[model samples]
Target: MNATPTEMMTIAAARLLTNQDVCFVGIGAPSAACNLARLTHAPKITLIYESGTLSTRPSVLPLSIGDGELCDTALTTVAVPEMFRYWLQGGRITIGFLGGAQIDRFANLNTTVVGPYDAPKVRLPGGGGAPEIASNCGEIFITMAMGTRAFVDRLPFITSFGHGKGKGDRAALGLKTKGPTKVMTDLCVLEPDPQTAELTVVSLHPGVTREQVQAACGWPLRFAADVAETPPATEQELAVLRDLHARTRQAHGVAA
Candidate 1:
């Protein structure tokens, strides 16, 4: 079966993980991708959730960080304070997987408010652990569907710092870890420019065009010198991902 764009994006993100990685996973798409990696190629990958589940290997995707399945499947559970103070802030997490309501050219994320701060058109859930996750992780990977409304030139509110304003911004701000190294979208894969720190298109998903990517982006998009085509999802990847989703739906008692 041909993979949907969302599935392709998740698989692409999952491929970036390694068995040696210790990932601090966010809920939603990032959760699915990290779990997919564990269920497939990166079986030994350590999965940590904000709710204090450490090294969890859930059979299905979790509805939230507090989902009981996470703790039940975890090798061990720690206090939320310890999870942050020791594991995350102590530089033990290799990757921070996240998604957001909006992202700017520099990859700064906004999940707070859509419009003005005080009186907003959409008051989104405030950033939970993302601020610390973005700052302390060895590197960060983002997953979100691309759209003009989401890939904005300016964020209404900066929820998590990426590259900040430009190249030296993170260093200037005294951030020691790499902020956002890659952003995997439904349309393509983006990485920070080596010099500029701006997000640039490095690979287009199957059948996705440069024009389509630009149309979806809110700013003037840039492409790498040798942009590559994202590999189509393998049968095994699709099968595993589908099975995971099916189980999640069944467990949650939702109609598939």
Candidate 2:
């Protein structure tokens, strides 16, 4: 069966993880991506949710971090304070997977407000643990659908600092984490330019065009000299992903 772009994006994001990775995972795209990686190539990948679930192996996609499936399938659960202080702040997690309402070229995320902080044009779901996840995890992996509206030249608020004002800022501020390392979207994969710390397109998904990716980005996006085409999802991956989504929908009484 052919996969949709969203599925392709999720699979592409999952490919970044390895069996050795311990990821601090968020819900929605990030959750699906990490779970797919575990169910497929990276079976030993450790998935930790913000709610203190450690090495959760949920059978279906969780609706939220607090979903009972996370606790039910987790290797162990810890207190929220311990989850933050020991796992996250202690730099035990390898990847912090997140999503947001808006992201800037520097990879800083804005989940607080759309227009203005005082009286916003659109108020988003305020940042929960993203600030800590972004600051303390070894690095971050952002998963969001690309669009001009979601990718902005200037974020109204920096809910989760990426590289800060680019290059050395995060380090100057004494953040423990390395900030966002990769951004996975429907069109392509973006990584920080080694020198500038600005997010640059490094790979395009199958059947995606460079123009399409550029059009979606709010800034003048940069591309690596030898950008590669992301490998297509294998049959096994599609099967597992579809089954997960199917189970999620069924559990919620939604049509598949």
Candidate 3:
């Protein structure tokens, strides 16, 4: 079966994870991708949520960080402070999965407001743990559907820093961790340009064109010299992913 764009994005993100990775998972697409990795190839991958669930193996996708399913299936739970101070700040997490309402060319994200801070066009949920996650994770993987509004030239606010301005910015800011190593979107996989720290398309999803990706982005996009076509989702991956979503919908009492 042909994979939907959302499924393709999720599966693409999932493939990047490994059993060795201890991922700090966010809710929504990132949660689905992490859980998919756990349910499939990366069975031993540890999934930690900001709500203090450690090594969680939720059978159904959670609605939020506070969802009961996360705690129920977690191997153990700890105090929020311990989860942040001991686990996150201690540098145990290998990857952090994040998404945002708006992201700039530098991958700096804004989730606070769409317009002005005081008089906003849209008041998005403020960043909860993303700022720390962006700073401390060994590397970050972002997953979000692309749109001109979301893939912006500038963010109204910097909720999470990817590469503050350009190359060496993170080090200059005294953040040792690698910020946003990869951004997986419906159309393509983007990696930061080594020299400039600007996002550059490394691969396009099957049937996705350069024009389509550019049209969706708010900035002048860049592509690698030898950009590759992403491998289409395999039958087993689609089967597993669909089944997971099916179970989640059934468990959540949502129509398929």
Candidate 4:
């Protein structure tokens, strides 16, 4: 099957996770990305779920952290406290993959509310363990589709701190994670500027224009001095991704 832009984004995101990475995987796109990595180049990558499943190698993508597939395939399961204390906060995990309702230039995420916290226009699923994941992991990789609504100028509420205000804010707050290091979107790949720690476009997907990306973002987006075009997903990657999703649908009884 040919890859869609979203699939391309997932493949690109998966490629970033190396065999050496111990990734703290989220449920949605993050789960798919990590699983793809495990199926492909990053076969040795350790996957730790929020529900305490460690080194999980599920046959299909899990619906949530509590899904039986995760625990069934995991090397071992620990209590939530031990998962957080000994694995996450203990500085064992290398990458934290996240998604957000709204993201700012500094990559601070808001999964709590859409509008004012007091009287929100939309109340979103509150961050579950994301704050800890953001703070404790060695680095964070955010995957989201780019849109003006999602790429907001000011987040109404910050559910997980990224670079915060940029610069040394994370360090000032005593956060051990390096904060958001990369953002993979349907249109492009963004990374923080080395000097300012502000999110900047580092690569664009095939056929995506700079103007399109700029228009999607709420704030004025920045571009690296030498932006590169993201390579399209190879046939092998597309096959793996398709198979993964197919099995996920089959396992859940979703129509193909």
For model 4 the local lDDT of residue 66 reads: 84
**Which pairs of residues have clashing backbones in candidate 2?**
none
Tens-place lDDT per residue, model 1, 65-131, is: 9799999999999999999999999999999999999999999999999989999999999899999
lDDT of each: 0.95, 0.92, 0.94, 0.92
Question: Which parts of model 4 are misplaced by more than 4 Å?
Answer: none
Which tens-of-lDDT digit does each residue in 137-186 have in candidate 3? 99999998999999999888899999988999999999999999999999
Better of 2 and 4 by TM-score: 4
Ranking by lDDT: 1, 3, 4, 2
Cα shift from native, residue 103, model 3 (Å): 0.7
Q: List model 2 lDDT by residue over 1-256, tens digit each.
A: 7778899889989999999999999989999999999988899999999899999999988887988999999999999999999988888999999999999999999999988789999989999999989988888999999999999999999999999878999889977568899999988999999999999999998889999999998999999999999888889989999999999999878988
- Give the alpha carbon lDDT tens digit for every residue of 15-106 in model 4: 99998899999988899999999999988899999899999999999998889989999999999999999999899999999988789999
Distance from true position, residue 9, model 1, in Å?
0.6
For residue 169, give model 4's deviation from the true position in Å. 1.0
TM-score of 4: 0.98
Model 1: lDDT of residue 184: 99
**Residue 211 deviation, candidate 1, in Å?**
0.5
Winner by TM-score between candidate 4 and candidate 1: 1
